[model samples]
Target: MGSVLKLYIQVAFAVKIVSCSITMVDNTTSKSPIDLSTAFLLRVDQSGQGDYKRIQEAIDAVPSNNSELFFIWIKPGIYREKVVVPVDKPFITLSGTEASDTVITWNDSGDIFESPTLTILATDFIARYLTIQNTHGNTGKAVALRVSGDKAAFYGCRITSYQDTLLDDAGRHYYSNCYIEGAVDFIFGNAASLYERCHLHSMAEESGAMMAQKRESPLENTAFIFLGGKITGVGSTFLGRAWGAYSRVVFALTYMSGVVKPEGWNDWGDSSKQRSVYYGEYKCSGPGANRSKRVTWSRSLTKDEAAPFLTKGMIGGRGWLRPSPTHFKKYQTS
Candidate 1:
């Protein structure tokens, strides 16, 4: 009887130890919620003890499948090179040392017949507080930021180019408090994107101000919705033009400058789009917000009609995602 009791006690103790061990392992291996604060900081001045000096190098060094929330903190300086964040690398954060101090300036446009300044093919990526520009001014299709991955976010970053400043190639993306400067078809692509509290600047030209969207699929209700943002441009720019026949875009509760053309939409030389594309606006204010005789195809959306497109769930439903503030803050306001 004594031996049996001792055995039972030992068994209970072993089980407890095993349970604790499993709990510790789970805690250590579980995905850490991404906050911009804990991500790595990349300083361009060669000051930190990080493994790499250049931002691209640092990004490359991260193990491809690293579940850890890796950050590349860029110090104050201009990084002049085309950067590609490929699909295999997810949960990577890129932020500047300071929003105003760090700059990623390059001179290649996708229209250069080959190169694009930045091509992001990774999901769960965040970029903040940096300037991404194609110094090759006025060049056609010069994409400063081309995002082709899902669950990507950009905050307080400046994306500048002449023709195609931002390419929302594919994905569900969030852009908040960022500045995008471009000319014809500047913000074009096939993504379901949301621009909240952003500034869209149109460079001087008669060729319309902003291009709201360019979605390709009828099955894909990909929409670009601008909320509480400002749109200003040079000469006269249409709010958007259909780069794809199935393009869908909306401007809601936005402040517009006179630069927005009354037509609100351009053909982009694709007449077939007139039948399929959907462009609309709601409660827009400013000299350019004139709705008189706006294109028959584009109209103002009712408040109820605009609700679904306004949230992050607009693209992928409720399980979509929430932006990582720490990661996003590192990149916002450039």
Candidate 2:
């Protein structure tokens, strides 16, 4: 409920997930002979020095049904590709040079299903210190990152797009110290995802919605929990919109800039969605957090209800969210 508790909850969550000594450094993979006894490290560089030139090449080289950790070091450069870690691949890591330096990008619209710059559909996948962008401009619903795998974690990463920046389609996900920017429903889908100390930026022309959660059933284990983050950007934006009957999105202990619309949640054109969608915020600050104008259907979560959002347990990722140490210089969005 409080910022201090949120910090403690996330730290405790990471403690349960992290274990090991072997780490990887890359411009893409560590090429040295891996001591599986220690760690599997592969280096990647577009200049053809690392294990693979393209990120997908390194990914394709990985053996399937892997139980051990496989780390890829991505060199500092702009990689133009749509990368996917299939459903059978697990325990994979794509470590980058830096969030700003190492970039994997593509341009695709959302006409067909699964149109994204990066789609991770494997369990126990981890990506750190990189920027995943969809350069398709604001023409349509372009997605930058789509995570459909279970128990995936993203640390110190930047996901940028115009319409749909991140589609947390399914699974339990953790995003820590990350930057996510888009215009409408940028952070969407039905994943049980936790965003800790991240930045949500809105690049809107007029009316923009930050998230579009699509949880249709009451029994579905899905929600978007944004804890201890900041919302800042241009134009008018709502905190989220309901994409399904039981859509859910929560912002706890966050700072909302003036660009955020006071209504906070939109039901789109469907007035019925307002009755079923669960949208809430607790103890948020900034001019955009003006509760007087917020919709009556939305709520100010009680501390008990808000407490769960701060913990990794809310996303059912308690045992596998171990985020490795990061050297990312925190970007300021103030």
Candidate 3:
């Protein structure tokens, strides 16, 4: 009778393992049934224990134009490669345990579009708890990250470079609790993005600009909005420079350190843009937030003027933003 009981216990354990593989909780808020086989979960470990040894290898395994989500869990290691998520592949999440442990770094300088350490050209992409860096020093146009895709979001990530750290190109994007460090036009592009609870650090030796927003025409609904974060840096820097005639950028409910230049904004050497650019500050605190020395064109916004940029509605994030997956479908590929 004792021998029979042992065999039954082993059979029960095997059944439980099989059941767990079939279905999993959805990452989104809805309780809809997500077919586990359609999606996939891949692992990357430098120690050779996981399916793929490199992060890029795992990303390459996903089929083109995939409809379901793919999760690539990267183990703690410094991956020295220039990674790119092509425009055809979307709904991918590249995650790490923490920013300090998992690092993706490259050394490329010159040419803004071609020299990024990591380029995300796919929509509905997510990056979490990872460090993306370009160790190109104070060189020209070395971009650490370039997000040219729509509906991309980053959470708890660190992006560091000297010039053009984050090229927020055409997209409706969101960044939360991220650490972005750079010197000159570090956060530049034409994306309609909202940054929440992020830390913007400057490494300028003497003078620089944090953002260079490029909104060419007034009809184009693109702007960069910063909410609930702190801007601290090493050298004096302007909050932004008008890279286009209708460039727009706003900072609300944030803390600005003394590193911010007194002028606050630059016209990018074109006086005509000074009349068309829209730069606003609302309910900000700290030593560098004084509007007294700010440019005449910049607006100290009223509550009504600031209302439009204070929430996620600015980027229409409620419809597409997804939380980290609570459950994952187990799968492996050689």
Selected candidate, larger lDDT, 1 vs 3: 3
lDDT of 1 at 62: 57
Best by the lDDT measure:
3
User: What does candidate 1's lDDT look like per residue over 1-334, in tens digits?
Assistant: 6743543343224222221111111223445654433343333335554345677776776556655465565656777778888888887767763456678878775453245677888888888778888877774567788898998888788888887788888888888899999877778778888899999998857765477476777888688889888987778788888877888888888998988877778768778888899888888899888899588888788988887766667766345454332321111111
lDDT of 1: 0.71
Report, for all candidates in order, the number of backbone clashes: 22, 14, 0
How do all models score by TM-score? 0.81, 0.86, 0.89
The sequence of per-residue lDDT tens digits that candidate 3 reaches over residues 80-189 is 99999999889888888788988999999998999999999999999988999999998588999999999999988999999999999998999999999999999999
Colliding pairs, model 3: none
* lDDT of model number 2: 0.81
Better of 1 and 2 by lDDT: 2
lDDT, candidate 2, 42-71, per-residue tens:
567899865589999878877677655666
The C-alpha stretches of model 1 lying farther than 4 A from their native spots are: 1-50, 110-114, 316-334
Kindly report which residue stretches of model 2 are placed more than 4 angstroms away from their true locations once superposed: 1-37, 323-334
